[model samples]
Target: MCGRYATTRSSGTLSQLFEAYDDTDGRHRPDWNVAPTKPVPVVRVDDAGERALSLARWGLLPPWATSPSAGARMINARSETVATSRAYAGPFARRRCLVPADGWYEWARTDGGKQPYFLTRADGDVLALAGIWSVWRGPDGPWLTCSVLTTAATGALAGVHERMPVLLPPTRWEPWLAPTGDPSALLGADEEWLAGLEIRPVGAAVGNVRNSGPELTARVPDVPAPRRAREDPRSTAEMPLF
Candidate 1:
């Protein structure tokens, strides 16, 4: 459900990484807590065959949608079903793109509460999440939007969550963007691509959409140890608090 994540790289760095020719908009700054519906950088191959870095709302809005707000619920498409879903079918077939991110946030739940974890590549390279874009026109105007693709989690990530975004390695990037042959072959790659990934426990400040800053990723001690029902004091009491 990738509702929030982070992207702190400078546009110049992203331009070089994606081979994008456009000049930096200067309006974009490093954000450690990007929430849903916000504008984020996306890399797509233009008709001229040149890669261009552009900002697009982080949710997918199908052309058939009556309004843009519908995109808020379409931020992610399951890799297994995107090819056939009405909201994602067209874009998944032809509007493939890349979403650059420094890291992503996932929540792990325990009896006490849910904790946020920041996941990133161990090599410190920007993750190019496989994404699909679409153009939605409404009473306001036209808008370019995108959504990330998620696959069944594997390796260390599987322990944290059952799903993770589809990550495209350098060798598969071009093949994913412009499929000349079997597209299904490009969908599920080897787990070695994300073997070196690392996940760090971060402060829960990111849980709040209004909060935004680099400190959101700061490491915080895990407190309030979770207690099993048999070890809970309330379980021994005559009645529960609730």
Candidate 2:
């Protein structure tokens, strides 16, 4: 499960890469360790059929949910049941979105302990983790929540973990972003695309949400004890996702 990841791209670069209109409410700080429940950038087709780069709470809250807190556990939806699951079927049919990430973090158990690794495209392409979203209303107001889709890992990733986010390829981006019916055809894991992926061990600091820096993702030989991550007072609140 992708409980932690990084999205260190500048807003300008992502706007052009996804050809999306910048819809974030304010400046988004680069995050090397993004955790669930935090608002992260997402690219999706608006009703106008134009791709818009917007922020969304990382956890998905079904439209019928009674409490916003339910979102935390809904951070990832399994691919096998997404089309039929009560919580995800509606969004799968109409609210598809592409989650932007430089890469994601996955931990592997070894003789020493659990070691974290950062996975990214070998050519440095941004990962569009397939996602579904919902618009939920509560006492506070309406919220745009999203969940990343996961499938059994295939390729180098398989040795790391049995499941990983369904990373979308550029060729399918247009169709997947179309605001229409279910696009299950475009939601499967792609080994051909995964062939170009690169994985490397990084500091254990990434396990801490307080960590925010390029060094957290810096490749390390073998992480023994990760350095303590500094805290950001303003980070606890989700960033604006307009």
Candidate 3:
């Protein structure tokens, strides 16, 4: 599960990379440690056939939800069930999008404790993760939200975790950004694409949400500690230390 990640690209760079035509909202700044429930940039197609870069809350809120928190627990949607899940069915059919990220964080367990790792494309290109968005209205107001799609990990990532975000290749960007009906075809992992990625162990400092900086993802020597059978989800709420 991708609970926290990092994005340090400038608005201009992101716009150019995604071919986004809209002006920047100026509200988003470079963040080395972005957590769930925060606003993140997403690239989606509009009615005019142009891609617009916009900010949407990381957690997806379904139209039937009574409050924003209703979907806070759904920051990610499993690729296998996206087409059938009630909360994601509609968006899966018509509101597909691309979530740009410099890299994502994942935690692994060792005899000593849980350690964090930062994974990125070997070429250093931004990851265009497959995502879906929704417009939900509640007693408070309307909100634009989205969730990242995850698939079984492959290649190097398989050893670290069983699941990883589905990354849309450049050629599939247009189709994914304007998906119609079911998008199950884009749910599988691309072995070649997966091979082009790399991972590095980082510090556990990222376990605290308040910690933010480039160093949060810096590589650190692995150390052994008493093993814990399970990890608490809240332990990943902050930037992971390497």
Candidate 4:
């Protein structure tokens, strides 16, 4: 599961990258360790069909939820069952969004314990993670929240964990955010696209959300894997989406 990640790009840059109008109102800041329940930037089309970049709580809160605390456990929805899950069906049908991130963190289970690894595009391109959003109204007002969709890890990613966030390529971005788009067709991880990614071993500093900065993503000394060996795709450039 993608429990932590990094998003240091400014709102202006994100607005330009996604070609969406900024709706964040200048409240977002660079975060290296993004945790659940925290506000995250999401790109989605409004009711008028105009794409907009806005902030939503990282955890999704279904309309039936009685309190905000329920969101913490709903941080990620399994892509295989998102369209049928009681808590995700509605949002998966109409509230699809793109979650922009520089990269995401995953922990590999090892004999010593769990070792952290950072995954990102070798070209340094931003990742548009597939996500679904919801709006829950309380006595105060309407609260916007979202959850990232995770699919079975494919290719080299499986060596790190059994699951990884569903990354949408540029060609599928519009369709992914479209209300009528078929989600299942775009749920799998493309191996050609996956070939462009580089998985680097990083320090344990990222284990603590309180620690922030570029240091958290800096590559550390390589260690022999107790699990499956991680493949290096540095020679492979990112290819077009299939």
Could you tell me the lDDT of residue 189 within candidate 3? Answer: 65
lDDT (C-alpha, whole model) for all candidates: 0.77, 0.80, 0.78, 0.87
What is the lDDT, from 0 to 100, of the residue 46 in candidate 4?
91
- The list of candidate 4 runs beyond 4 A from truth reads 230-242
Mark the 10 consecutive residues where model 3 has the least summed lDDT. 233-242
lDDT of 2 by residue, 138-221 (tens): 889988899999997764466567788988999888788776645888876565677777777777888888888889877877
C-alpha lDDT (0 to 100) for residue 87 of candidate 1: 86
Q: Which pairs of residues collide in model 2?
A: none
What candidate 2 gets wrong by more than 4 Å, as runs, is 222-242
Better of 3 and 4 by lDDT: 4
Instruction: Name the best candidate (by lDDT).
Output: 4
What's the TM for model 3? 0.87
In order, what is each prediction's RMSD in angstroms? 7.5, 9.2, 5.5, 3.9
lDDT of 1 by residue, 146-183 (tens): 99999977655655566888888878778777735555
From the highest lDDT down, the ranking of the candidates is 4, 2, 3, 1
Off by over 4 Å in 3: 222-242
Model 1 clashing residue pairs (backbone) = none
Which residue runs of candidate 1 sit more than 4 Å off their true CA positions? 222-242
Query: Residue-wise lDDT of candidate 3 within 1-242, one digit each (tens)?
Result: 77888888887788899889654578778777889998888888776767888788999998777778766699999998898999998888989999989889988777756778788776788888899999888666777899999886654465557688888888778878765644787677665676667677778888888888999867778554212212432222122232
